[model samples]
Target: MNKDFNSIVKVWEAAVRKSAGPKKRANRIFSTPMSVAHVDDDVYQVEKILNNGDFYTGQWLNNFPNGHGKYLWTDGCMYVGEWQKGNITGKGRFSWPSGATYEGDFKNGFMDGKGTYIGSNGDTYKGFWVMDMKNGQGTQSYPNGDFYDGDWKKGLQNGHGRYQWKNGNHYIGQFRNGLFNGNGTLMWQNGNRYDGCWEDGFPKGNGTFRWCDGSFYVGVWSKDSKEQSGTYYPSSGSDDDPLEWDPMDLFSVDLIDCYVCGCEKVSIFPSQKNLNMFGLEEDNNNKHLLSKKVTER
Candidate 1:
């Protein structure tokens, strides 16, 4: 074995002896391949044994907690797996003194990884973690039967995801700092659906909102209110009308004007009696009518 390994083993042996006490010496001899160093400091396994005989185990390097290990405090809190200089690191499991249990990645003794935590109240969280909190993608279930599945950050629902309440209310979309922000869609149990941008949990920005009663609005939204907008056109006939119309029909009026104006004026009237016949009418009606008329020589 390497010198370092041998030295670590010796230290581990001494720690075991110290913790086990003289009475338990004859029970068994504990062994490990870990070493201790008193140069920069003392490397030793630290343990706290309760009066009831429950034991907590961990490591101390250079008189401080270091490396990968665990500690079960006398208070009933138990931490197992991974350590760095006495701080939790890497993947591990932790059971709170209150009966809650967490299993996942760890960093500096905090939960950080792809893991799960079951709360004492029966709620549960399963997903990515950061510093003992839920962050990134995951799922959370409430004890009261509510649940959320979506992106998370620093233990809050942030970014995009879906929230389903026990009352059958649901919101799916962008979130910020746990509140509805950006764009989202809300579906209420009453059969109404609101699709639009949100700010501070209120509808804000442009969108199309529809109610279960066949009413809807498509326009700019401002803080849950509809501004100037267009009709919803709820019926299927309104939806299909535009598609049924021929594309060429839009130019029909213009086509008629162009054709008629290009034709000869005489051909348009077709009767000389109708043309300049106005002159003869003025002559017959007396010069008073003629005085009102300008001679078009």
Candidate 2:
């Protein structure tokens, strides 16, 4: 009978211990709330007060903003957007007190992917960016009404593009290092146009220049000057007939006073009218109009 009573006591003690253990655990859990600090009186939201005095208010994971949040720097700079592990990693807008701002994709707090940046001086850029520099295809607009749209590399104009100036001048062609370096066309405000090869922003090779007066020149150029051989086409209905003359050609001449311009270098083939008036006749092929020792009063 005593052995049976000791066995009963052991069963009762086991039951009591089981009941008390769960009750103590329940009390402890209820008394001590979750360790996560609420952001603004809401237990669901979390905030991280940075050591550098920068304030962040948003969802938090392990004391760092992990979800969408806004961070305000101590120097009046602010960024409001998605964050991953305390780094700006997604779409966000960062602004400065100096009126400079950037709004676009961010990778590790650096401007990456498509974005737009507006400078403090009213300059603006919109397009692909890499490491905060203009790269790939993009468009830049200056405050003075100048605009550029084309390929860029390392912040310099490269590849094909179009640049328009505020003075109604424009260029469309291949570019390298921010200068016209290949075939392109330039139009001026005065109705003049140049279409041809370019180097260092000037016509350098074979090309055509059309003037506002309807005259045109087609030939080769060197350092922006017509060189060697070129053809000049005058305007329609012009009284001046087609003349083939080489400016570099040498001619034989005697010292005589020109009745016209009084210049030492006189035109070789004066018109037939001038020849008749001067009483000069062609000796052979009529190539030389001025006779030997002939003077005009």
Query: Which candidate comes out best when scored by lDDT?
Result: 2
Give per-residue lDDT, candidate 1, residue 60: 52
lDDT values, one for every candidate: 0.54, 0.58
lDDT tens digits by residue: candidate 1, 1-297: 244744654454344433522121112112222222233344544443323333334555543446555543333455677666435667778765445777878765456779987877777889998765578999888777777888988778888988887777788899787777898887767776778877776656676666577656666555222243334445443543322112122212322221100101111101111111011112343321121222221
What is candidate 2's lDDT per residue for 1-297, written digit by digit as tens?
A: 133744654454344333311111011001111123345532223333333333445555443456687664444456778777656778888876455778998876777889888877778889997876678999888777788899988667889999887777788898887778899888777787778887766567778777689877777756423464567787787887655433222101110110011111111111111110112223454333222232321
In model 1, what is the error at residue 141, expressed in angstroms? 0.9
Model 2's alpha-carbon lDDT is 0.58
Off by over 4 Å in 1: 1-55, 58-70, 224-297
* Model 1 global lDDT (CA atoms, 0 to 1): 0.54
In model 2, how large is the Cα lDDT of residue 277? 10
Pairs with backbone N, CA or C atoms under 3 Å apart (clashes), candidate 2: none
TM-score of each: 0.56, 0.63
